[model samples]
Every structure is written in C-alpha cells, then in structure tokens.
Target chain A: MTQKTLRKGNEALAEGAIRAGARFFAGYPITPQNEVPEYMAAHMADNGGAFVQAESEVAAINMVYGAAATGTRSMTSSSSPGISLKQEGITYLASADLPCLIVNVMRGGPGLGSISGAQGDYFQATRGGGNGDYHIIVLAPNSVEELGNFPKLGFDLAEKYRMPCMILADGILGQMMESMAFNFDPVDPNKIGKFDWAVDIHKNGRKKSKVFSYKGDNLIADVTERAKRYGLIEKTEARYEARNCEGADVILVAYGLSSRACLEAVSKAEEKGLKVGLFRPITLWPFPSKALKEVSQKAKGILVVEQSLGQLVQDVKLAVGDSVPVGLNAYPAGGQPDGEQILTAAKSLLTGKKEGLFDLQTHAEGFTYECKRDLSLGVQGDRKEVK
Target chain B: MSTILAKKPSTLTDLPMHYCPGCGHGIVHRLLAETFEELNIADRVIGVAPVGCAVFADDYFTCDTVQGAHGRGPAIATGVKRSKPGAIVFSYQGDGDLASIGMAEIVHAAVRSENITVIFINNAIYGMTGGQMAPTTLVGQVATTAPKGRDPKMQGWPINMCEMLSQITGSKYLARVAVDTPQNVLKAKACIKKAFENQVNNVGFSMVEVISQCPTNWHASVEQALEFVRTKMIPQYPLGVFKDEGAK
Candidate 1:
C-alpha cells in the first residue's frame, strides 16, 4: 500500500535511499543536508542496514566506494563544500565502474559562501568536477515529492550505468516541508541481481574478481568504453518537465529551486496576456537538449532563471543555439528569485530590453567589469554592479 | 617422495612482484598469504592495495583486491568491511601512504573500531617515489628531500603510529614488529597472524606495523639494511605489542 506523509526534503531523500535498497550510508555533517545523515543514523539499523557518521567527507565517500564494490546499494550525502571533498572518491568510483548514490543538497558557493539555497553547483554536478574523462549521472529534483522518489531512480541509474548518480538539490528544497508519497515497493538489497564482478565470498571457486580504476596499458580503450556507456545513457535517459511550452512566446528554463519560481512565473505571465512557459530539467546531465531545441522553434525567446549568477544559461544557449536569443535572470549567491521577478525578466527578454541582463558569456564579463569598475573608483563604487 | 618443509601459499598468485630486490614488501606479502592460508580464510579475504610500492598488489594476491588512492586504504577497507561483514578485509599500506598522507584515515578507522585488519609497512622512507622522507623517517635519516640528515628542528620527530593508535579505545589489537632477522621474521609473521585473527573474530580494528627494511631507499646492501633496522630503526620503533584488547 502507498503511504503519503508530510516530510522535509532531506528526510525524504534519506527515506527514499533506504527504500531503494541502500543498505549502507556514510556521511558527515553539513547544512541543509544534516537531516539526511541524522535520519539514516536513526532508521538504517531497523532495516538491517548500517550507517556511519564518518569522520570527514573524504572518509564518507571512500566508505561508499568500498561498500559499492561489494555490490551493495550504498550512498553518501553532503552540501557544496563537503561535496567538493568527495570528488576524488567519486572519480575513483567512476573509474572502477562502481555504482553508488551521492546527494548534494547544495548550499551557496565557490567557497563556503552561505547556508542559503543556490544552484551554484550546476557546472560541478553536470560537468565532471573530478580529474577524469567521466560524467556522473546527475538528477535535480525541485519538490519534496520528487526528492522522495529520485533516490531510487538515482540508485537504479547508477547500478544500470555502473557509475555514481548525484541527487542535486539546493538548500530551499532540502529544508522545505511538503507532502510526499512512497508509491513503489521497496527493493530487497539481496535480490537486486548479483554483480558477477563484485568482490564476494560466494564466487564458488571461479576466478576471484577485482574492482579497480587503473587502465595501465589500455587507457585509451578503457576511456572509449566508458564514453560508449555514457552515450547509451544519454540515448536512454534524458528527462525533463515541459509545462505549456507549445505555442508560447517565451520559455523560462530553470532547475531545482529556481524551476519552482519559473513555474509560478509561467502562470503569472500567462494571466497578464504574455505567453510564457516553463522547461525544468529533471536530469541536469543528459540534459533535455532535444526537447529544448523543439520548444525553441515555437518560443520567440528563452529566459534562464537560476539561483547562481548564470550557470544554466550556458546550457540553454547550447540547446537553443542561434535560433533564438537566450537571456539570464539570475539571483547571485543565496538569493531566491520570486515569481514576480521571473515574470518581469521573461517579459523584458521578450521585449529585447537586455541592458541590465546577462547572456551566456557576458555574465562573467559583467562580473569582471564590476571588479575593475569598482577598483577604478576610490570608494566601494556601487552595490548594484556587484550583484 | 619429497616432504614439503615450506611451500608457497595457495593464496599467492604466480605473478612476479615488482618490489625492488631485497625490499621488505615481498616478505610482508608472503606473510599475509601464509596467514590467510593458515587461518583458512584465503578464499573469502579481500585486500586493499595502497598507492605506493604495493600499487600492483591486486596481481599478487589470489583473492579479490582493490587499489585505494594514496593514503585512502583504511577508508576504502572500512567501506568493504561494513558492506560485507562476512568477508575478511585488510589494507596493506606503506609509511608514506599510511603514517603521512593517510594519517587521518587510519586514526579515525581506529577510533571507530572498524572490524578490519591493516598491514602497515613502516620503512621510514617513501620507497616507490625514489627515497623521499616519510612521517616515520628516523631523525638524522638522509633522503632525497633530507640530504643533510633530517633535523628535529626542521622536521618533526618520527611519528609512532602504533603508540598513537593505542590511545584510541576502538583499536582491538596494535603491534610493532621487525622483519630484520630470521627469528624476527618469524615473530613478525606471528604478529601479522594475530592481527588478522582479531578481525576474523570480529573484535575491532587491528594493525600490525612492520618495521621493514628498504635496501634501495636506505641506499645500502641487504645486510647493511638489516643492520640499520637492528641498530637504528628498532630503537625508535621498538618491537612489541602496543595494545591487545582481544587478548585472553
């Protein structure tokens, strides 16, 4: 029987991991995601599972690496700075073709920026943060309901692809409370098909299997094989949500927390006789580029709204190409853009009033200009330019 | 009919090791193989190879093995042990890999009392990286980095891992042993066996710090290296059990 309950996003993510047959969880303390480990530490033992509040984020991720190699569904969660520390182990997991779940309940930052909600880690999540020709399957969930469901999806994708799958949630979604349902049957960890290559005692006299990332003399062949797997994943799994995108004048592209605001903005813009629709990417990697390209043919302009300065705008540009103009309405570092703000930006983008707004590359250029312009003046010039 | 006095353990594969001539890793590897065989856990044992000289350890062990990033062997072994508690897991690390870069991992693994065994090879120098200084490098020891004998003022004192780990309550067994002499080699094997036994019993974290000779790194002959272990290394890293919570 399915059960619905009001739950925080971090707690829902942890519960979803448990239901997905993740028998092992190792994580350290971090903001917005602290509830994840706290919940796991309390409930994991009841389900014949193990939980370790690891000494550090590095230890926690490597612990996941170890458990995953044994063919167990294992996981770890952290915020931005902590996720940075886990990159080495994540790369190792990718190299070894070990499956595991990693959740980044992202807080603001290039450093320890803030404890507030931000999608600043889009590049780090979608693109490879670690040193390797590898990509982690990245799933970005906007609501608590999706948070309650995506861990199972993330684990399945990770196991199917033999790579780490990331649940990239921001601080708002992590801390917000919403009603969620557990509709699917919980999987049995033991019954999740045996991995022939796992390190186990039940090999039954066959050659002992090893799990390692070293390519030695076969580096080129090894990387090519990995790239082929990624290609297959892209073909099979590019997920997104398109709302009222057909026959719309403007399409607002966003993900995670920003996507929620964009959805509300779509409705507000429509009510005001302006035609705007929302395109929310559920899987940040294997991005719904094809869908965006199709939607771009119908829409006159694309406005990308995000918590960071302008990370997702680049992807929007790539998806739309030179077919339509793409502008960014970004709330830099920890600030949340409201529905009205997004609606105004969408209208401005449609009217081509891009004087104060930013595009794909100009956002960075704008920041550089602000830095130089501020230094040119003796005093702290203007706060508007900084934002 | 020939009576076999000593034969290679079945746990050891036929592949030739890459250890330099007279390096202590070969002896340590043989000891681990023999221990696995004698304990009757050879087939079920999974080993973690460090990124130092033993990086290719997966080729030598008949049992399943994984290579950990430099200094991450214990963290990796912790994951392996927790996931498959029925399987016997161990990590083999060098001084630079363990006492230096991996200090945090080993310390916390001990604090958590993870039920696994660690075979720490403390040769006092980075062997694979061409004789660089290690955390366990003896005071006044000369290396590429410390050409003028290591100064206590410039570099800190040698880290005593077993003694440091003994203070942690989670560690069930801790020992420091040498493989310099024939009799000492036998003792070192016994120490290693007990450490693995503790893990088999699911006691807690157990570690055997082997005071091994690195002839190439020490820039000496095998005999001179053995003498160095006897005269120099032994005094700083005395051979004995530091802790044994599992002892009767």
Candidate 2:
C-alpha cells in the first residue's frame, strides 16, 4: 500500500521534485509559491541536494540552467511577476535545449496585481511569453494530488525531449491542503545515466562537449529541428479530461482552479435537467484542441470560464472555430467564479441570450494604486508620517 | 640539440582567437591556460563564457564550456559548481558583463560564498559593442557613448569591484592585478591560480580582477593602451589583494 499524507500543494511539489532526482533548486521568494523554496531550504540538504535562495529571479533561473547543463535535475519556482523576470533565461534555456522544471504558482498580475489566485497567465504559459519561436511543455493541475505527481512527470518529459517543462498552478491550488499518496519510488541522482552532451570531465578520451546556445551557421537547421521535436511532443503528449459530454446542450471549458468550479456548475446544471458537460485541459501548451473540438461539435454552445478577464476564451475560439458559438464568463483577478455565476452564464448561452464579456478595465476602479496624501506633505507634518 | 624555451599550453585549442590586436583578453586567456596546465585541472575544469567579445571562448578552451547570457556567468557558475562539486568551475567575464549588468549576481554569489572561481577582465570599456562606455570606464576616459571624456558628475564614477566585493564577509579571496607588463602577467597568473585553489580547497568564493587593455575600443595604439593601463586605470583600481580570508 502507498503511504498517504496531507500536504500543501507547494510542499508536495517540492517533495515530488526531490523524489524525481532533482538535486539542485534555486529560487527567490514570491507569494503563492514561497512555500516551495522554503520547504526546499529546510529539507534539500537532508536528501543530498543543494538549495539556494537566489538574489533575484533572473539569477535563480540562470543557476538552474547551469545545473541542468551538467546533467543534474534542477528546478525553480515563482509567481507570475517573478516568472516574468525569468523570461530571458528561459529563452536561453530553450535555445540551448537544456532540460529543467519551472513552476509558476500564479498570482494576479499585469504588475503585481494581488497575492491571490488567478489564471491570467494562461496565454503567457501556453503561448510563448519568452521571445523566439519555441514552446515549453506546460502542465496544469487542478488538485493537490496532481500537483504532487506532475513535477516528476514534468522532469521526465523535459529530459526525454531535451526541453524545459512548466507546471502551471495558481495560489488556490498552491496553498490548499489535501491528502495525497506518494506511490512512486524516489530517484537517486547518482544512479542516473550519463548524458552524452553534458559538460562534465572527458575522462573516457571523448572530445569535450560544449553546451552553448550559439548556433552560428546552423541557426535555421537548429530551429527547424526544434520545431520537428515540438510536433512530436504535441502529437504524443496532449492530455485532457472530459465529463458528461453525451447529449449536452452546452459544454463548459476551464482549467486549474476554474475547472473545479466548472465541475460544480456542471452538477448544478444537470440537477436542473440542463444538458451541460465539462472539458478540462490537463496540458495547456500541447493544448487538447482535438478533444475540445470533438466535444464542442456535440454541444449546442460552449462557455469558457476563468478567473482572469478572458485569456483562455481566445484559445477556445482557436480550437473549436465557428462550429458553435463560444461564450465567456470571467471573474475579476484575485476572485474565483462561483458555481452559480457559471451556471447562469451556461443557461444564458444555451437559451441564445449572449451576455457581454467582463471588462476588467472598467471594474478596476478601487484596485488602482494611489500616492498617500500625507506622504506628499512636507516637514510640517509629523516626520514619521512623512515616510 | 636546443632546449625549447616555451610551447603552447595543452589546455588551449588551436582555434584562432577573435580578439583585436593587443587586446588584453589574449594574454589573460594564455595565463588561464598556463594555470590550468600547471594545476593539472584542465581535464576536470568547466568554464562559463560571457556574452561579450570573449563569447567565443568555448572554441579556444579545450575543456567543456557553457555560454551564458550577458551578466549571468556567476549565477551559472554557482549552479555548475553546486551540482557537481568535484568539477572545477570558473566564470570569465568582462567589465560590462560583470560590474554593470552583473553587479547583483556577483555580489550575491560572494554573500553566499559559492565555491567557484571568477575571472573578471576589467578593460574599462565595452569591447564587443565597439568602444561603448562601461561601468568600469575611468573618469576622463572617452568612450563612444562618452565622446567627451566621462565626467564623474554626469556618468558617475567608475566602479572598483575588488574594493566593493572585499566588503562582503563570504568572499574568501579577492585580488586585483594587471597583465600590461611581463612581471604583472606573472602576478596575474599567480592570483588566478590562488582563486582556483580556494575553490578546490572548498574555502569559499574567490575572484581575480585583471585590469586589461583594449586598443581597438580605446582608439589608441598598443603601446598607448599599455601606457593608459599603467597611468590612468591603476590610480583608480590599485593592483593588490583587497581581501583574503583564506590566508587567515
């Protein structure tokens, strides 16, 4: 029997990385994902691993790049804003074809919007946030159990393809506690096989291998090869989950925390004798476009639900095309869409009543930053208040 | 039979270097190659090259090497050293790569006392970008951006990395040297060897800053460049050990 333990999502992911043979972790602190580096700092040494609280997100990602080039399993984690700072290094990692695990336990963003959960990074993760024509394998986990299991899967996929892989979660999933089973055997870094392309000592009389990003005259050829590899990954690794799509009037599309809300809305719609189903994308990058298209063809309409304004709805439109009308219901950043709201939107779409898209710009009246009036006052005010 | 006075170090490959005539990078590369041969660490050493004129350094070094983004070599070196503690790792960077864009990385690596060696080449100008100003460009020195000699009031004073890094408690060794003269080249080699030795002994973070010359960027002859290093650069960045906790 597998051992079961209740753990926070962030802690389980860190432990999962260790069990996957990740021996190097470097990260900077950020909300929703701080527990990852904090847990690694406390336990990594005990597992014969090294952990570093890097000076900045830029340095942390570069550190992971170095370790990964040496054939060591390495990882880094951050929230949305911190992950933005890591884009340069991520692009370099992709260009060099280095394997590593990157986790973005997303928070509200567009510039440090809030410390709460948000799925606003759907486009940033699925489409390339980093420059260049490259794609990272992106995995989305709706539950804590999947969060614990996905890091190992991510590492395996990254190494197998010689590419970086990302685990995209949100503050809700990262902070929530749930009972999860640790079924797989822990990996030993020492027992791992050698990489022919790694930058280790050439004791076997082989030529020293240079792990550099510069392609020189082979730039076109190199990128073409990467694109071919991406095609293979898309064909082999696209994953998704579907519920109650048989004879449904409408299908709801969501992922991560939003998927959980969709499940509840599906049950409520079913209780009212409305034919509604759910389509949750497990891999956001190699997006389950085929699965979504197949299910959307059977439904009368599709409702895309999310925490952010309307990021995932764009992808839904691309996948299903004009076969059926795709509607969107978006809660504000830092707020989750409840079952009632999703049900109402689904019912409205099914009845041919199109609800307007949620506009974050108009709704952000109270959330804007303002300079404190007291700080603008000169020394006439109390010195303590001046600050 | 005549005794051979000198031969090329085995640590250096046959690839022709990309540095301009009289550039200090060539001399520094030679010293590094000689040190690696003398210490018998060439086979196990892994070098991190910066995104500057020396970006092609992997072609010149016989050992395994990785090219890092501009100003990120130290962080990369820290990762390589930590992952494979047995492998000798070093990062080679230039003025703009280290003092300007990479300042935070080097400072934090020193604070963490990462067991790695850093070879910092301070030429006082951005060589690859064709004579642009650098953070280490001496006051009153003219660069492409500072066509009128740099004014401390406008461009800020040149940074002395050896002095600043010495203040960090985790730095086990810090030294500033130049390769303009033959004697100074020997001293620079010795300083580099000691920095690498500190990492091998697991002492702590170590670095050697080499005050170098860039004739092409300076728009000066090779002789004038050497003279400029002695007269102008030395006054601002004195050649000596700034800190050596390992010695104590």
Query: What's the TM-score of each model vs. the native?
Result: 0.96, 0.94
Q: List the lowest-lDDT window of 10 residues for candidate 1 chain A.
A: A372-381
Predicted structure 1, TM vs. truth: 0.96
Candidate 2 chain B least-lDDT 10 residues: B239-248
RMSD of each: 3.3, 7.1
DockQ of each: 0.74, 0.76
Candidate 1, superposed: residue stretches over 4 Å from native: A359-387
Model 2, residue pairs in steric clash: none
**What is the per-residue lDDT of model 2 for residues A1-387, given as tens digits with 9 covering 90 to 100?**
147889999999998888888899999999989999999999899999899999999999999999999999999999999999998889899999999999999998779889999888888888768988898999999988889889889988999999999999988899999999765788888887888889997696678889898787998999999999999988889999999987878888999998998899888987888888999999998988888999888789888888766788888888998898887777646777777777777877777543323322222343332222221110011112212
Number of residue pairs clashing in candidate 2, backbone atoms closer than 3 angstroms, sequence gap of 3 or more or interchain: 0
RMSD versus native structure for model 2? 7.1
Which digits, one per residue and each the tens of the lDDT, describe model 2 over residues B29-103?
A: 988898898888888899999999999998899999999799999999999999988999999999999999999
Best by DockQ: 2
Q: lDDT (0-100) at residue A59 of candidate 2?
A: 100
